[model samples]
Target: MANTNWAGNIEYFPTDFHQPSSTEEVQDLVSRATSVKVIGTRHSFNHIGSPTEVFISSRNLSRVVSIDRIEGSVWVQAGITYGELSLVLDSEGLALKNMASLPHISVGGAIATATHGSGFQNQCLSSQALALKFVLADGSLLEVDKHADPELFQACVVHLGAIGALVEVKLALVPRFEIAQSVFLNVKFESAVNQLMEILSLGYSVSLFTQWKGDCLDQIWVKRLPSEPSPDRFLNGIGASKAQQKVHPILDVDPVNCTDQLDIPGPSFDRLPHFKFDFTPSHGEELQSEYLIPQPYAQDALRALHAHQSAFDKHLLISEIRTIAADSALMSPFCAVDAMGIHFTWKKDWHSVKAILPLVESVLSQYQPKPHWGKLWAMKPKQVAQSYPGLSEFKKTIQKYDPNKKFQNPFLKELFED
Candidate 1:
């Protein structure tokens, strides 16, 4: 039903939209179509999965297929969102290691793009997959996991919607745990950048939100275990003060949409992510872009961004910086090294955002930044190729799985060779 991405910057009006209720239906649709692409929540800022011949929506496919308590794993239909799965996991007294700021995204889509949560050690969501099930080009089911086919497993985990339509995801789980979220206001941007790694390590998951126009970082969100000690200040108790009240990541928005904060302990499902899943984001007004470079370069890379504070301030709504550990998935940006994610949420002025992106990329180019596959980036196809060394192998894996190329789309076609 929705033709555009959540940001509404790119309009994708597919010729055919099919909502398949079960794997059988998905297989039927795929077999009948000449070409196809699958869409989850349509949260992606890019046109990565926009289909030319057919569009398959995962809306009706949300369900839990099985659970393995002894093995600590769960098999969920591709359409189930992290939020929905969280509820099921909570009942089972299990939890995921991390979650993105927004839990509204479907599990398959999140893993496909290697979406990650903020933490010094947490890998992207794709790393949690024990196995994945896809309906391939010929309406035949194919499954891959670490044990079955390590190479193909690694390749398809973050397949970018190319290998096939991901029908199911088998995710690893942990015992459910409680976390307390705290916020610090007005941290000195310079000092914060200097001790970026230390700040990120303060919690199980942490995020830094900023408005580049100012000298201070807007907020530092820390999600720590209940037993962890709280800090009164940072930079020898001079840079920031604890937030007296809950605050939204954006400037002047209502904090009601945000999760509980100020040292309140809550279930992992509630505290790990920034917002509650029941409420969908108000959209069509913003666009986002992100880059992940090695963690060692974070401080210097951040300094390079400040030089364009004026440009960022004019077109930006908010920006966040987070850390991600290296993942085994071949195509993941953080595959080779631990990374620091620099994210930009720009106001819906695509013209200005478009014009200013080259400048942003130029500043970050020295760090060998890798763009978030789900978000916007100005890098040319060749530059993207250079950024991810695993692309060639990834291409080979997909080509093997979908020999007919029924799952291919224009976005993937540009970067990959036949």
Candidate 2:
């Protein structure tokens, strides 16, 4: 039997999964394989990691290769999870500027999908890449940095694993800092609707959660840096009051897996992510989908989603709204445009979620929303190709790195099949 994804929504096709313990071993396996796909921790919700013949698992390859204090950067194996990296950095009094809501995802997988945290000024994870090392389709090790190979690096950083296997990554780091997380409850939907941008800018990092069944938001999670003072009782004007107790992002679920809330101060790694590293985040049985729309259309997008509350409520478990700063990565959803990501965490029934996505896409179509690369979506190849201005150039870069298409998979074929 093949393994299912972390959400258990996707059952990978039957194939040999390789666990290479070293760079030389990874190169050897790729050189001999007829087809290959690189996977990390199986956290994806779709068949993006499926392989025709062989799949490379980087779990055993994880290692913190170096930490350059002078350069303020860290070089880590692609398989290492952000949580692992964070702990190492914290011990040295260093940190990454931002982290995704879930810390379990591998560094390479997150960067490949342009995963992001909630902050108007914090760019997606890929933006932290100073350099990367890939084992190309032809078994050649290629290294590129942003300054020396801007166009190729931009395209390669978020290539969706279409170019090659990213074996190592160098990321920019910052001085470690402390943060406090607080949850505000029952903020009127109207207030969030009216002051959407202002509400998003309320903290160093903010996340608004709802289930679309009520007139008000279920919770508003705010993570503030030490320098940013949080209001004593926030969003009171909108009927939102700080939660007296810790709460999970999904209501009714135990908050044991979540980070410390109620304004308890902790390290950046602990507060930046919604879930704690020691416990599973969100419900284990769920499917996720997210769309990134430019900030200019945020209000319109919010209204559009709200209008379909009735239709979406039945299939949805929870939804979150987050903001990401603009970036220059070629295929990132927020490429060159600061944007908002409207994320949906749905019940385990794939059929219902699949049926409803077209409706969701149709309504948000006018906004030219970019579907997150790693999540489930019903978008067509033409629609995806047209959404990114740099798609053509990105395709060219993929071809240059993998002329024989050894890295190609069914998913890539469907998206790039012009």
lDDT of each: 0.88, 0.87
**Residues 240-344, candidate 1, lDDT per residue (tens digit)?**
888889889985999997989989999888998999988888465888999999998999999989877886688998999999999778899988799999999
Worst 10 residues of 1 by lDDT: 229-238
Give residue 345's error in model 2 in angstroms.
Answer: 0.2
TM-score, cand. 1 vs. native = 0.97
Ten-residue region with minimum lDDT total, candidate 2: 229-238
- List TM-scores for all candidates, in order: 0.97, 0.97
